[model samples]
Target: MGAYMSEKKYTKDHEWVSIENEIATIGISNHAQESLGDIVFIELPSVGNSVKAKDEICVVESVKAASDIYAPIDGEIIEVNNNLENDAAIINQDAENDGWIFKMKISDSNQYSDLMSEDEYKQFLEQ
Candidate 1:
């Protein structure tokens, strides 16, 4: 796997996920941000909200358009990055890391293994 994508899994919807302990950190992939252009605002979910896999968990608005960010797996949101409220451009600056949208207490760890690996995600994007 590429160095940056080492622990990250990509979704067809342009989201990326990385699990540490039982917490799954979720964010949009770099490709998603590039497509969205300059980000302006974000609507994050409440910290204690429970979400199912594929649920729309957040909305990211950018200069070009607004896009919905979905949950990659079933989980309860444990925390959200409030930093984005003041400066949403952080996503444009770093989509995969510092721009992470939320972290959740995973309900099913096995669901993570089903996401695309970096290489697979690259191929998916090419299709």
Candidate 2:
């Protein structure tokens, strides 16, 4: 894909959030998709659905397992990646970019502080 452009915040659970103009784009990390193995299906939350921090907002099914994708912060979902319905394997191909799951209007800007920076997340993964 294109060069990495966003400053991403990551969770211990393997989700990532990238905010721009109060809209937080959410997706699973590459490490997560690699672990899931050959994603086959995705169930995304509907647009406008209210989600709390840590709520299960979507599901991804792969040949090896099914995993719940959690909301990184309180927000209302404003858009979802419909492309995943037809080709969930995109997640395995590019989990951080073209495979983003949803976009939300963040309810609390401060929640951004709770997530790890790219460097911190890398260290976390090492641990």
Q: What overall lDDT goes with each candidate model?
A: 0.92, 0.92
Give lDDT tens digits, candidate 2, residues 44-88.
899989999989878899998889999899999999999999999
Off by over 4 Å in 1: 1-6
Q: Give model 1's TM-score versus the native structure.
A: 0.94
In candidate 2, which residue ranges exceed 4 Å CA deviation? 1-6
Residue pairs that clash (backbone atoms under 3 angstroms), model 1: none
TM-score, prediction 2:
0.94
Which consecutive 10 residues in model 2 have the weakest lDDT in total? 1-10
Compute the lDDT for candidate 1: 0.92
